[model samples]
Target: MELTILGTAAAEGWPALFCACDTCKRARAVGGKNLRSRAGVQFGKTHRVDLSPDTWYQEAHLGADMSALEYLFVSHSHDDHWQPHCLAYLRPPFAHANNTPVQVYGNEAVVRTGRAELGAEQTIAVFNEVAPLKPIPAGEMTVTPIVASHKVGEQCLNYLFASEGKNVLCAWDTGLYEDESSWKFVENVRLDCVILECTCGPSKCERYHMDYEHYLAFKERLEKAGSVSSECIFVATHFSHNVGILHDELEQYFSPHGVCVAYDGMKIVL
Candidate 1:
C-alpha cells in the first residue's frame, strides 16, 4: 500500500486561518513540511482517510490526480474532517477524469452532513453511512469502522483498512479507547502500521486527545502485549498547535521508540 500524509495538523490547522501565535509565525517562516493543513491521508489515490477544508490544497500539493480517489473514509463530521460545502466542487464538470463515483462511508451524521452535496449533481458519487465493527468494501480495501471517543451525536471513527492480508489501524479523532471492548479488540488484531493522533501535549489534560506521553504509553502497551510486531510501523500524526512542539522535537521523542512522526507530503509504502 502507498500511504501519503496529505495534512497533519488538527482542526484549526497549523498556522491557523488567522492566528498569530509564535508557532504559527515560525511555521509560516519555515514553510515546507512545517506547513500542515487539516488532517487527511490518501492511500494510492484510490482511498482516502478523511476530507478536510483544505482538500484543494491537498490535491494540488500532493499532485494527486483526484480521479484515483474512488472512496473517501470519513472519520467524523467535524468541520475540519468533513466539509460538505466543498464536496460540490468535486461534482459534475469539476471532476471528469476517472469519473468514478466516489463512495463515502461514515456514521449517520457523516452521511447526513455530506449527502446534501451528493444530490442534484451529474457527477458519479455516492455516500454510505456505516456503523462500528461492520465491515465494508471500498476499492481494494475492506474497511471496518470502529467507534471513536471524540464527540456526542456523531460517529467519530477509527478505521481498520485491510487489503491483501495487511491491515492498518487508522486512528484519528479518537481518544484512548477507555472501553474494555476497544482494547480487547486491539489486543488480538495484528497490524502492519498504526496511524494515530497526538493532538494533546505531554500535559495531563489529554482526555479528548492523546499526548506524546499517552502515545508512548500506548505503544509500550502494544509492544508489551506482543500485539504489534517489531516490524510494525507506528506513525504519530494529527498534531495540534497547542502541543507547542516542532516536528523535529516530536521526532526525537518518537524515533527512539520505533514511532515515526509524519510530515506533509511524506509517503510510506508498506
Candidate 2:
C-alpha cells in the first residue's frame, strides 16, 4: 500500500491563512517543506482520509489526484477535515469520465453535511454513517472507527486501517482516549504505522488535542498495549504555527525520539 500525506498543518495551516507571527514568517520565507496545508492523507489512488478544504490546492500543486477516489473517510465534521462541497465536483459539468460513486464513511453529522451539500437527489457519492469499533469493508481493507475525544457534540472518530497484513492507525484530531474501551481494538491488532497529531506542539492539552508530552504518553500507552513494534513507523503531523517550531527544528526534536515529522506531500509505501 502507498500512503501520501497530502498536508501536515493544523486547521489554520502552517504560516496560517492570515497571521504574521514569527513562526508563520519563517515558514513563509523558508518555503518548501516548511509550508503546509490543512491535514489530510490519501491511500494509493482510491482511498482518502479527511477531505480538507485545500483538496484543490493539494491536487493542483502537490501531485495529488482526487479524480479516481473511490472511498473517503472523514474524521469529523470540522471544516478543515470535512469540506462537503467537494463532493459536488464529482458530478456532471464539473467532473468527467469518473462515473463510479465514492463511498463516504463518517459520523452522523458528517453524513448530514455531505447530504445537505449534495442535495437529496444527488448520486455522485454514497454516504455511510459509521459507529465506533464497528469495522467496515472498503475494497480489500477493513476500516474500523475508533472514538475520538475532541468533539463532544458529535461522535468524532479516528480510523484503524487493516489490509494486506498491515494495520495502520490514524489517530489525530483528538486527545488521549478517554475510555479504556477505546483501546480495545489495539489488543488484537498490531500496528505497522501510526499517524498522530501533535497539534498543540510543546504543551500538554489532553482534553481536545495532543501536545508533544501527550503525544509521548499516547505512544507509550500503545507500546504497553503491544500495539506497535520497534519497526513500526510513527509519524507526527497537524502542526500549528503557535507551536513556533519549523520543519527542520521539528525534525531535530522528534527524529531523536524515533518519530518522523511529516511534511506536506510526504509519501510512504508499506
Candidate 3:
C-alpha cells in the first residue's frame, strides 16, 4: 500500500489565510514543506482519507488525479477534514470520464452531511455509514473504523486499513486512547505504519487532540503492547499553526524518535 500525505496542516493551515503571526511569517519566508495546507491523505491510487478544502490546490500543485479516487474515508465532519462542497466538481461538466462512483465511508454525521451536500451528484458519489469496529470491504482492502475521542456528541473515528499483508493505522483528530475497546482491538493487530496527529505540538493537550509528548507515549504503549514492531514507520502529521512551529522544527524534534514529520506530498510505501 502506498500512503501519501496530501496536506499536513490543521484547520487554519500553516501560513494561515489571514494572519501575521511570527510562525506564519516564517513559513511564508521559507516556503517549502513549511508551507502546508489543510489535512488529507491518499492511500494507493484510489483510496483517500479526509477531503479538505485544499483538495483542489493539492490536486493542482501536487499533481493529484482525483478522478481516479474510488474510496474516501472521512474522520469526522470538521470542515478542515471533510469538505463536501468539493463533491460538486465530481459531477456534471466539472469532471468527466469518471464512471466509478466514489464510495464514502464515515459515521452518521458524516453520511448525513455528505448526502445533504452531494445527493444530487449520486452518479459520482455514494455515502456509506460505517459503525465502529465493523470491518467493511473496500475494493481490495478491508477498513475498520475505531472510535476517536475528538468530539463530545459526534462519532469521530480513526481507521485501520489492512491489505496485502500490511496494516495501517490512521489516527488523527484524536486524543489519548481512552476507549478500552479501541485499545483492545489495536493490541491484537500488527501495524506496519501509524499516522498520528500532533496538533498541539510540544504542548500537552489531551482534550480533543494530542501533543508531541502524547504521541511519544502512545508510540511507546503501542510498541510495548506488541501492536507496532521495530520496523514499523511512525509518522507525525495534522499540524496546527497554534503549535508555533514549522516542518523543519517538527523534524528536528521528532526525527530522533524515529518518527517522520509529514510534509505535503510525502509518500510512504509499505
Tens-place lDDT per residue, model 1, 1-270, is 878888889898987778888888888888777788888888886888888888889888776546667888889888889887666766557655564667888888878767775676525557787867878977678988888777866657888888888888889887788656667666778888998888875555546678877787777777777778778999998888777767777788788878888888888788
Please give the lDDT score for candidate 2.
0.88
lDDT of 3 by residue, 38-126 (tens): 98888867888999999999889986667788999999999999988788787667778464688999999998998888766676788
lDDT of 3 at 12: 89
- Model 2 lDDT, residue 170, Cα: 90
Provide the RMSD of all predictions against the true structure, rounded to 1 decimal.
1.7, 1.1, 1.2
lDDT of 1 at 153: 64
Which candidate's lDDT is highest? 3
Candidate-wise lDDT, in order: 0.80, 0.88, 0.89
User: In candidate 2, how many Å is residue 83 off?
Assistant: 0.6
RMSD of 1: 1.7
lDDT of 1 at 190: 83
Candidate 2 lDDT over 48-76, as tens digits, reads: 99999899999898888878888999999
